[model samples]
Target chain A: MLSEPLIERLTETPLFAVGLTLAAYLLGMALFRRLKQPPWLPGILMAALLLAGFLAISGIHYTAYQDGAAWLSVLLGPATVALGMPLYQQLPRIRELWRPLAICLPISASLAAFYAVGIAKLMGASDHVMASLAAKSVTAPIAIGITEQLGGSVALLMGALLITGVAAIAFVSLVARVMKIRDERLIGFALGLNGHALGTVRAFEIGPTAGAFASLGMSLTGIFTALLLPLAWRLLGG
Target chain B: MAALSGFLWLISFWLIGEVVVYFTVLPVSSGVIGMLLLCITLALRGGVPESVACAAQPLIALLAMLIMPGVVGVFFIAGELVGQWTAILVGLVLGTLLSVVTTLWLMQRLMRGHHAE
Candidate 1:
């Protein structure tokens, strides 16, 4: 019923893109709840997929959507800064567990990167792709920079990172159950460090203290891995 | 004075991360390095200013949204991505599985240590 130009202009708006993303996220959330899957599964990745599909079906250029989605992107800076508040509130517990977390985060984060890269290589992926995939479990922005520096595809790395988050959301509970990990602090921290945002959400649901630790782990892991990955790459001649 | 210090702290954290990445052979980012530097500072200093913490809270809360622009940027390359869909799908699935298993295994070890202690 709409004119072609009208539809084009409508889709080009940032609000439309944000709306679509939010709708997809809500849909994913509904499906997750219905299927008894974890919140992160539907909340983030599904929203991404749905948006991807919408663009595909509509034959709309990604550049068009970019106009609308950039606003959402700007929020990332503030969101990252805001994470400090929650961590600040949990200072007492963080203080108590400082030594343990300090030791655990670096080791865990490094292994996660190593294993991801090793397996990707074993699966016969190209060397560049492997490099990009290495930092997928780290947060998105950091992963992008690392992927670019390693001479890998940023597109591939972003896809890998989102998938990593989804996988973490999907399997974290099962892993927790199988491993019999009881301490909320450790579970949440491990999740955040290795899983990033999705893992942080899971940690929050577990408990506020656990959520705080998860943020700590997520922030620390991102920082440490970012610093370490570049050095590791150069050492490997990447 | 406290607010000024907090702002300075944030900048220092960012710079430290950049320096580490620039100097190191690793494939990591300066921002991430900055985050680690901040964590260490917190650990050593005990805590940041309450006002600083408050200011940072809102930013962290929306951290995920900050990255959305990059994600949306993917739409611009959706054509290329679609062309490589099969490889991307394979990579995502396998990479995710590998991350989960490895993280869980490591977490279990950490949990075991916690329980033992």
Candidate 2:
């Protein structure tokens, strides 16, 4: 139970938390660049972790920062809408590969969800946690919704997504090498489908075409996973 | 005009998302659905509004930033998360590896036929 004054203080100025997060992200980006590691490694995850540490050290509760940080969350809607432009620009190529794009997008999304749930269950995760885990590959908001629908915790779903993005960034290139998968577009698409925004950013760095495909993959995965997870859940009796 | 166009584009994208989700039964966001919808529309319509494109660009640039807020929620629940960290970590790593491999394999098969075509 929190005191009234503490609750008010917690909710009062979320901007500070937002600012702290941005600063941490920028610092992490600079450090990752200086170290010549992958940019996504530090960008979001490091920022989140460092901020968490700082708040913990300062004895500021998580609720206090969230009050200020919710503003950043609101931007996700518009940012998602904004992805339309590059997708629009990539229309010609998309048309050229429409059949492949259409077929691969759903199949890849289904496999990603299935593998996540199956493996988690095998490892002995409970049904609800597995439901949240199933949406790990998609973007955050949609994944959160899917988590709720499947009777899982939204916070758990978010945590799972952040970790998934970080891991994809760290190992996707390695996996590509192992599989001998070479096409830039395919690599980008794979990363995006599995990694979400972090993978899409990596794809952009690889090349414009790769970025475009990755964006396409990310968007398609979000849609596909959201639509299919419930049906898959029922079939799995989850 | 920018606001109006942004709103219209948002609606268009949302409709596109709903239609795609409805037809394909894929659970995607309205924005991504909107992006795919816009892609097809541009292909058929053969162009896009310069203003619409212009308006959408900055928004995209701020995407990573946009997601920060939702992620910040983690800070609030850090204690609880720390307790269940192992399951979360395992789920993320294994899920990502599986998805990436699956996506790569599926795309490879899909693209194999494309090269043949």
Candidate 3:
């Protein structure tokens, strides 16, 4: 709503986009805390929605916004490399229950990719969307890496990551209870295995054991998928 | 300086991963390879370096924020994704439920000896 020249000048710079993103993220975090942090509504998801709505309303093109925000994505590489810390930290827990996790992880991770892609394929999602679908079960940082390798849409993968994460919480809570599968370890493992980081946080709320296993689930799933999905894509896609 | 060094450690591993990927043509994420390398290094060392922990933990925690922009790019592709929402949603919801249910069932059966514990 500024003078036309000023508006054009402001919109031309990357800072404008960066500022909006941070502002939205902070606002989302604040509102999330105020609302008591619902599992179905993560702060990042809220931030995403806020940013999307703003872009939609302001008539600002997403490419223009992306030009400025691309700087933030540069940090994703470092953040992904940082996952080693948690994997190392949770290694003991992984060792303790290595048997079940070793058995569950490959199947869970593979099934996650298989169903997501197969269903989306049935739905007639674009080839890009189907490609992105394969990595949603892994945490975002690593998932982004896989998405890039597959030449998939990072946006679609993020959406899938968030939905899978939230759905993991709901199903684990409802189904796990109904079936009398009460072990925090099992609950946490399922959460992380399917939900990634979001489910890991939820598992933490359950207990330390749950938290640790959730960490383990996400970390292992991430590493496994990151290493394997690209190869599988090449084999199958070729 | 310590935090900087920690970042240096992480970046260094990433570079190492890049180098490996460049050579091997492995079709895998270099950062993931780097992550595995670092994890293995930590395992061998039997402890996390303080600086690496300080740097990596916060970065790991803030990863979603860093990747936030790309996620919002969904808007950019709104046209492409316009009619595909139904498929994406159904796949996401069902795939997630199935994956979790499968994990819970498998873990319950495989870890049954510890069930009573």
Candidate 4:
């Protein structure tokens, strides 16, 4: 720990912001690996928790943190683009099984949206909450867009997205183990379809091939949800 | 130069995705659209270019970190979330489990014949 003046000066600089985030993430990664890679102990979640806790304790605003860390978010675009590597590698297999995937993927995507919104409604969630819940399985960007299109609260939508994503990460493996899912591709695809980005990352942990199929699941689900969600919203009376 | 080019390459496709979405009125995000276009490019080129791979690899490795800000933002709304925690949690857990289980079952059952072949 540095002296008070040095610490104060460091916190005021952009380097401090970026350094804090990276350091926390590295620490989380080390802890995750040392802990034998528990799903709930995912590095991203841990890093977020550590940083969020720090911010809360230090009284630093999220906006100030964002200013330094925006570069990381910008990389999400390229990282998403890089997902094509694994998807492309798996193309031959995808083509071979195109028929089943063509049918299965959309059905899964629609069911993901429907079940989420339906459960929320049954549990007496507000219409706005229902709308926000509509695209809960899709990746954040598309989910955020759909939520806005349906006039849902973005803040609440963000909360729901984080919850669904984190929960999917923690529980999807347990579901896979219980179901005896052995095919890495199937496991990855299921996670991607339901888990979104976090699911893809989890799939990467399983193997490169799993990561590939997971991206396929994630990307195709995004496409399907984007195309059908507005009509679905109208039908749901949102 | 390599990283900048890599970033440019990705951003170019992202821009293209945005344009296509605008013209077609698709609900998809620009990033996914860019991903699709890059997939096509890879298919045409016969492999992921080393430059693109190099540029994208670091970002991919650190992918998890990128989502932290959004998760942290959730804290800002902790008050509102507490009210609906039960419903939200139940909907997320049950819905995710049901969806993942059903899809896996369906995929396995549907693809069994293919696997046999």
Candidate 5:
């Protein structure tokens, strides 16, 4: 039902792929806001599904989509750096809470990695699968590098990372409520420590202070886990 | 122009971070290093620059969208995912929950200690 020129333009041009991503995300944002921002329907997940569905229906490869979307991906680095603004705004509190935060972040990050690999091993997963799962809680950029160093499949690591992020966003509120967690800082730190970037999104929704702490947790987790995972792997003789 | 300037500054910080990581033995990513550098700068300056805040606001606003491309990469390996679905799912859920609970408990314990002091 499509014209030859239109199909050609879509497949051959970069604009179509880039536009597709933005359009999908915009629609996801609209729906998310309209629906009162449910945790399960986080904008990124919905947008990814929409984009993935579009690619599936059109028979286009993800690599083709990446051709146009790569520009947006490049910004992830700067956006990450930009997180310093809010964190700087809340630096005093972060300083005051540094003792607890510094102590808790590395422990939780290692625990997340250890528990993930442990469960994977119990479930009879191969070493590569275990390695991929070990870095599930860190942000994608750092995670990909860690996975490479640990000799895991990059595709599997990417999938597991998103899965952990979505799960963290969806279940965090319930977990906090059940645990009787009321302090926003603690809640944010927990989310960021476990969830990474997606968790930071949820923390922002809770409050600015929470968002700041979440950013702190995310950064610290990335730093600690990246340094420690390889050392831990060597210690385990992997 | 302020937003543009802020954007450039953030990118420069990122570049600095990349250079630092390239030279150093630290395992942290350049983006995070940039964030730390900027945080220290802001703290020393007594506040964040208006320009940086302006640029950072919109980027943070759509932070989810920025990461979507990587997430969409998931579609490419659907076969592997289906095969490993059970183990991956169980591991993710357990790992995330355990991390959350332990961090919360330890944080509270530490905070209580500080209060007692």
Candidate 6:
């Protein structure tokens, strides 16, 4: 129903990138529904892949896409703040579990960064690579900011984040089988701590209790990492 | 309308976090600080506002989608990923293994020791 010039002008604005992203997401969701929504196969990742392919084929630049896409990315802040709701809802369990969680949280959260950065360093990567790797275990919204402050490439961190999240599906189940740890709380906590948002989604699929715990785990771990990683980076001179 | 107010509350906390960071120069995400402040506030309130509950449900549910645009940025810098693929794979695999395993094991040991649920 639009004229050719109008269409071209709209394509040059933020609408083009936003519409493309939405379309890709919808398609990814459709495909994900078809596949029964496996933990390893998240719709976001699928949409990202499709969007990338579309950009490449159409000869569109990432910069062009980013100009508009930043608007959507900004919503991540509000979403992060929204996490407070679930954490609030889980108040009863948190009070009950606070003692043990107090002991367990700091250690697990630290190792989440330690392992990623430690291994990436062992692999002979650059300092920026290590910095990017450091925050991969955290959720995207917080992780992006951490990575930026560490002078790492956001794009590279996304790749590492995806790998880490997808690996979490197998990791939790593997823990269950090999470690004989089947308590949904521990399982979901492990999943969210190690996997971030993707793991939280998988946790929700497991049950309401697991979902709440996963939310708790993800939020606390995010806060923990955000509070400390920069200090650690300063101390270690990363 | 309730959902809209909930969103407003979230942004207010987020802005407070940003202001705190601006003054303190904390090298962390304002969103995270915002989340922390929101938690503290909710703890004081003794419950989540219904508006917040409603707004948070859908936002958290669609978090993956909200995060998509940023992840898609990877395509722009795919070049940087060229030589580092091995590091990424090994890092994710072993790192996640160690992380998940140690968390479960330690939490188990602690919880079992105290008989805490």
Top lDDT prediction, candidate number = 3
List model 3 lDDT by residue over A104-214, tens digit each: 889889998998899888878888888888898899888987888899888878878888888888999998988898889889888888899899989999999899888
- Give the per-residue lDDT of model 4 (tens digit) for B4-103: 7877898888889878979997755677778778888999999877778777777666666765666677777667655676777788778887898778
DockQ of each: 0.32, 0.49, 0.75, 0.60, 0.62, 0.77
In terms of TM-score, which candidate is stronger, 2 or 3? Answer: 3
Quality of candidate 1's docking, in CAPRI categories?
acceptable
As a whole number from 0 to 100, the lDDT of residue A16 in candidate 3 is 94
Question: Which candidate would rank higher by TM-score, 1 or 6?
Answer: 6
Which model, 4 or 5, shows the larger DockQ?
5
Compute fnat per model. 0.37, 0.60, 0.79, 0.61, 0.69, 0.81
lDDT of model 5 at residue A75?
85
> Which structure among the candidates has the greatest DockQ?
6
CAPRI category for model 6: medium
Clashing pairs in 4: none
lDDT of 4 by residue, A83-183 (tens): 66666777887887798799899899999888887888788887877887788888776666567778876656666766677777766678778878789
Model 2 agreement with the true structure over A165-231: per-residue lDDT tens digits: 7788767788889989889989888878888877888888889878888887787777677667777
Q: Give the per-residue lDDT of model 3 (tens digit) for B5-95.
A: 9999999999999999999988778788888899899999999898898788788777778878887887667677888899999999998
Chain B TM, per prediction: 0.71, 0.65, 0.92, 0.88, 0.88, 0.89
TM-score of each: 0.73, 0.82, 0.94, 0.85, 0.89, 0.94
Worst 10 residues of 4 chain A by lDDT: A1-10
lDDT of 6: 0.85
RMSD of each: 4.8, 4.1, 1.9, 3.4, 2.6, 2.5
lDDT of 6 by residue, A1-238 (tens): 4455654576677878888988999999999999998777788888899999887777676787788887777888888888777777777887888988998999999998999788888898789788888988898888888888899888888878888888987888887888887799989888888899888888989997787788788888888898899889989999
Report the candidate with higher DockQ, 1 versus 5. 5
Superposed Cα deviation of residue A69, candidate 3 (Å):
1.7
